[model samples]
Every structure is written in structure tokens, then in C-alpha cells.
Target: MKKGIDWRYRISNKEAMMGVVLAILNFIWWYAFAYGLGSRPVKDYTYILGFPAWFFYSCILGFIVFTILVWIMVKYFFTEVPFDVDEYKKEETE
Candidate 1:
């Protein structure tokens, strides 16, 4: 440990778990609209301009929603914790 110097900012395992969960959620969400829902109701959905509901628009919207969720989690829960360098040093010395 050094005075006026902080050794921190280690990535949390919980963050990794969260990322995995989000990825899975994205996969499920996208898959539901793309395939799970099948090829019927999606085709019936009215288009705004010309593109169909099952086109790139849905994909983009899903990505935007996913991004917002991840951003919220990062902004709220992500944090830096101080690491004990001396503890590691002592273990290495042993």
C-alpha cells in the first residue's frame, strides 16, 4: 500500500454474473421475437413506413432496451473496492 495511491478497481465477479445474465436475457428476448414466436403474428404486425415488424427495427429496439438495462446496472451497482496488496505479498513470500 502506498500513501496517496489507490490500488483498486478490481472487476467484481457479480458483474460478470450480471453480464452473463443479461446476455442470456438478450438471447431469449431476441430469440422469442425472431423464432420462438414463429412466422405468423409477426408478419401480421403493421409496418410504420414500409418495413415489416420482423425486420431490423425489432432487433434495434431490443438492443436499445438491453443497453439501457445494462447501463442502469453499471451506473448503479458497479463499484471499486480496495485491494490488499500486503496480503498477496505475504502469501507470495510464504
Candidate 2:
């Protein structure tokens, strides 16, 4: 703790938990699409925008979902704390 410093930032437990949940969701989605579906033998399957089924679901769609999640969290869950350095103020006054 330094005098006259007016900066403080910390991640709360709720924020951390939110991040963990999102990460797990991403992992599961990737696993299901890339490993589970992609591993299947090539059959009369279809592709999205020329991308393989696995890549489309695991990467493209997952990217969209992840972006939305991040946007929502940042918009509503984020907190900005205000900091005031009283010691610095008194020093300047004197």
C-alpha cells in the first residue's frame, strides 16, 4: 500500500465463477462437436458454409455463443470501483 496511490482493482468471486462456467461450456461444446461428431465416419453429412460439421459447430457456432456470453457479462456484470487518495489530497493542500 503506497501513499497517494489511487488505483485498486480486483475480481470478485462471482466474476470468477462466471468465467469458470463459461469456460466449461466452451470446453464441452468443443468436445462434443470436434471429438464426438468429427470422429464419426464420413457419410452423407452436410457442411455449413463449406466448413465441416465439426468445425462449424465447434469453432464457428461456439465462437458466436462465446462472444454473446462475454458481451452480456461485460455489459451487466462488470463493476467499476472509484478510488480516492485522501493522503495525496492533504499533501497537495499543505
- Residue ranges of candidate 1 with Cα displaced over 4 Å: 1-11, 41-45, 81-94
Q: Per-residue lDDT tens digits of candidate 2, residues 4-72? A: 544343355567788899899999999999987788777845688998889899999999999999999
TM-score of each: 0.62, 0.70
In candidate 1, the residue pairs with backbone N, CA or C atoms under 3 Å apart (3 or more residues apart, or in different chains) clash, namely: none
**Candidate achieving the largest TM-score:** 2
lDDT of 1 by residue, 1-94 (tens): 5554433433566778888999999888888766633466755665645655554445867889999999998899777553678874665569
Error of 1 at 2 (Å): 23
Model 2 stretches astray by more than 4 angstroms: 1-11, 83-94
- Quality of model 1 by C-alpha lDDT: 0.70
Supply candidate 2's per-residue lDDT for 25.
Answer: 91
TM-score of 1: 0.62
Lowest summed lDDT across 10 adjacent residues in model 1 is found at 1-10
Q: List the residue pairs that clash in candidate 2.
A: none
